[model samples]
Target chain A: MALKGWKELPIGGVIDEPGKSREFKTGNWRVLRPVVNLDKCTHCMLCWLYCPDMAIEITVNEKGKPQMLGFNYDYCKGCGLCADVCPVHVIDMKPETEFLKD
Target chain B: MLTNIDLKKAQAVTGAEAVANAMRQIEPHVVAAYPITPQTPIVEYFAKFVADGVVRTEMIPVESEHSAMSAVVGAASAGARAMTATSANGLALMHEIVYIAASLRLPIVMPVVNRALSGPINIHCDHSDAMAERDSGWIQLYAESNQEAYDLTILAVKLAENENVRLPVMVNLDGFIISHGVEPVEFLPDEKVKEFIGELKPVYPLLDTEHPVTYGPLDLYDYYFEHKRQQIEAMRYARKVFPKVAEEFYAISGRKYDFVEPYRMEDAEYVMVALGSTNSTIKYVVDWMREEGHKVGLLKIWMFRPFPKEQVQQYLNGRKAVVVLDRSTSFGAEAPLYEAVKSALYEASARPQMGSYVYGLGGRDILPEHIRQAFEDAIEGNLLADEQRYLGLRE
Candidate 1:
């Protein structure tokens, strides 16, 4: 997108476009990525609730039951907040380089 | 929702009460304020209206002035008509958020009951508090009397809410002199005021769930300068928008207002430029001087934030000399009003000889005689070499 001049900006510094946060790839700043162990997951959705970046997604099962879909790294900075808040140690923060090597 | 208003009745009340009456008539959506000396009565009176159901305003009695300003910013950003009042140290406390509100362009209206800023601390009439925030990018209107205090408060809401100039506005009234002193004030009826101010149509409200928005984001070198340029453009827009709004207000009230009010400046040889309640005494002194065959007049600055450069130059260009009366000292530097008026005149084709006098610091009393002497000194051009002339200060 072309950069707007000073006069073209919205009044009062208001960012009018919805979901413009998606344009900023904060995932580039992530050093560690969360690896979720789906087998031992309790489906408590605590990590989904605690994810500061709203990276965690929840999906519905065949019977319309809710299930954890782990994290989406598009906008997440991988702060390990979800790993810290997990009840059963279902998630672990792994170095991004190590995950890439795997 | 414009109701039929009666403009004939007048009530005797203090400036604070007058402003409160205006607030009750306008009936803003939110008012978040912390009480301080002199400004306390304004919010206190409005709070009673809230309690008594006279107005359906959500009054947030915040713990501190900072929080009060912050709450107003939040409310205003959410597309609500928000307002607050403060004085002296309270204004000092809300200093940070004051700039934020303006930069965010929330259109929050505030009444600043002017009082002296502290070192030893004073609770009297002075412009130190409002002067401290002169460069905060808010539109400032100074009131010389209780009636003006009430009128300007109502008008400030309309000015700030203007789509082209979506900046915060402050109405200043002298602390004890105007806030506490009782005087006769005429008010427009509630329905007429509602029609005059119109409705609050926010461009991009945070509360609009379907169309989301972000405010106060981190804009570094990439766009910070551009954003500041946008704010300046808005201020420029205010210079044009103010008169249009004032004209609409005049239609209802039959009282006309201008950015700078020139009193007897047409053929005067010397002029005195001042702000706030001091102009009243200066006008009286000018009349006395005129009777004595002295060609002197007074220029009262009703709007100080936009600075009214062209209007000021228009009135003072041909004058022999001009004296600027500043109630607040700039400490080590020249007084704020003095520096502003002097710089504004520098661009004129024919610049008048200018002098600065700093007076009434910490609520020092300024008598008519003191103003008379200032005008006389300006006419004589006696203090041309003096850096700063001190007025009414005991040696």
Candidate 2:
């Protein structure tokens, strides 16, 4: 049994499904994830705006390369808001249905 | 299923009593209210419910409408299903906190017994009080009759509490006309109402000791607008959630309401826009006018805050002209509601020529004939010259 208020992994790290909980994986699941092409991308953060769970983060480099951040699947329910709002077609919602592969 | 519901034999009650009965059914955790005309009976019945143990809710007798709203906001933030009722000047008094409740995303339900705001005070019904705060971040539902008033009160709670629509809602019932007028209102069982509402647990409520977060944060000019923008987003979410909530309510309660109710508008050459109780009278006139081969219609706006701009745009796309009836005046300027309808029409791809007429100030009785005249006038001479047309004032 887990210690009371203790024995946890990193926040937004891998989370164990609670005992007897049903797995609810559906939709276009992306495993490797969509990487942004910064030269063609505008940081409109429409992906960030539409994210229901606030999982997507946008970071900039010294050269001002705006990159679409990766997913924290522990926190992400796999809702493809990030893909839907990718105005410049930079971030693609590649299927991660393999995560549920036995 | 609900073969148990006896719609006919339900006791005849006023709008206030219907609201009172609905409140009793929900059994709120706390009720903070101040007495005002027409709105008094709802709080009175709630107080009696507390006394009789019909509802295990705490009845807080606040000194003013400000404190009434303040108390409910505090209670609601603390994870209690808080509620209150006020009218006219009282709702106006609770003004500042109304925006606060919605910003904090507190699912507080307030029944605004529609009354005229005072200057030379007259005790009467008008949409002036509710319409004054039309831009406030709260879902607004205007009821045409006592039954809708009662049923909408219950529906307001469900809509306001939904996760997608975690915002406050005010159910506006025109004072005296509906608040005092008796009509047979079906009373749903408390268990049935409870089942429909499910549980009252708010997401990350203020009272939770395990995980805590600050609410109603003080934002500077930089953040304040963004916070309000988020509120606008929430209101948009609410617009979508409202119909779903009402559909669920209808499944259980056998009552229904559309945000914007249209009457005989399919082939309307001319139409009238109205809110609150005036719609009831306008509907009657529309039906009568249609019988005489006139293509007149009425669009009654129930949900005002998340103004159904697109919905109204779609409905009024091909109309020749629309006469918006404003219950409250904007003094030297155009009526506030008339301005909203005009603005909404402006956004439409092809909007009909819309005109506004200010009517029914300080509880003046608006007759069906006045509605008929407005329809006829809009159709004829295009009497769109005056931005303000008084409804029932002696010339």
Candidate 3:
């Protein structure tokens, strides 16, 4: 969203939109990004619990089994917390510029 | 919609008690009080009111003044009518969140008993506490008597809750002098007060689960300045909304209130300017000086924040000279009220010769004679514009 002028902003700095936090794509300024392999042997969900930004995505399949998904880059600040917390060593830190060309 | 208006009978009550009575009538949704000297009896009485089932309010006995303010901030953010009362040190402790309360535009009403900020450890009447928060973005109203202490507190709810003026308000009374001394204060009908204040229509309330919103979110450089500017505009808009609220109050109470109450300024060449309870002393002196044929009047300022600069200039414009009495000083700078009056009259085509006096620090006695001397100096042109003369201070 475009930044508003002083008069255009709402009174009292109230951000009325509940889920606008996703609009802040913090991955741009990060030096490196965390890449994860969802095809790992085990889905321990350890990285999901430790990711401070809630960037580690997890989904449930139709069989009621937890499946690990890739890192959500929208809010990930490239903190490498998810890479550090992954037990299977499937997640790695790579340069954010490497994925920029894609 | 205020009708069948009848002024209630007057009863003598201490200033603190009067404030409590006003708060009870308003019946705020929440009150977080941590009592200090001169501001204790106010919340104590309100707490009793709550205990006795007189008014159903969630009165929190907070551990500290900081948490007291924090509690009310949370309550008011959740779209409740919230209030608190505090004194010198208490206000200092609440200072950080006090700014947050105003910046967040919560229409919280607070009663501030003016007391000396102590290093020498004094519990007495002075404007130091309120003066320190001059730029904190709260609308400040100084009460001269118990009647004003009662009336303005009630009026402040309407003033604060006005859609255009959704900022916190501080209704101030002198410590001990008004807070403890008994005075004949007229009370409004409880239902009339509730009717006048209407309801709290909070904007973007945090408690609205159907439409969730953020309060006090970090804006950083991207939007912090804009939010601050928005709060400044809210303060500015208060001046425009003040009179409309005052008019509505007049309809219900039959009392007219203005930003500055001028006591007999017509055709007067010399004027005395002051705030808080000292106006009563200056008024008595003004009467005495008029009987002896000195054309002197008193301009008792009621609203200090969003300072009534234009109204002050209009009143002091044609005067030959004027003396401004400040109950608190800025240590090195000209006193707050005096400095404000000087700047307000700076652009006047016929500016009055200004005499600044700092008096009654630490609740020192300000007799009528001190006010008479100030007026005499103004009339005789014996005042030095550069000097801040002390009144009743033992050098």
Each model's TM-score?
Answer: 0.85, 0.77, 0.90
The model with the greatest DockQ is 3
In candidate 2, which residue ranges exceed 4 Å CA deviation?
Answer: A1-102, B1-7
lDDT of residue B370 for candidate 1: 88
lDDT of 2 by residue, A1-102 (tens): 221221222111112233211233222233544445667767777877787865676688788866556655545665666767788787765556544563
Residue A43 local lDDT, model 1: 90
C-alpha lDDT values of all predictions: 0.88, 0.78, 0.89
Q: CA lDDT of B209 in candidate 2? A: 62
Model 3: CA > 4 A from native: A33-50, A56-72, A82-102, B1-8
lDDT of 1 by residue, A1-102 (tens): 456789788866678887776786678689999989999999988898888877998898999878998788877788998999999998999889986755
- DockQ for all models, in order? 0.54, 0.01, 0.70
Expressed as tens digits, the lDDT of each residue in B293-390 for candidate 2 is 99999888878878888778878877888899888877678887788778888777766876777777777888988888888888884666345676
- The DockQ of predicted model 3 stands at 0.70
Model 3, B237-261: lDDT tens per residue? 8889898889998898888788999
Chain A TM-score for predicted structure 1? 0.75
Could you tell which candidate, 1 or 2, scores higher by DockQ? 1
Question: What is the clash count for each candidate, in the order shown?
Answer: 0, 5, 0
TM-score of 3: 0.90
The parts of candidate 1 lying over 4 Å away from their true place are A26-102, B1-8
The CAPRI classification for model 2 reads as: incorrect
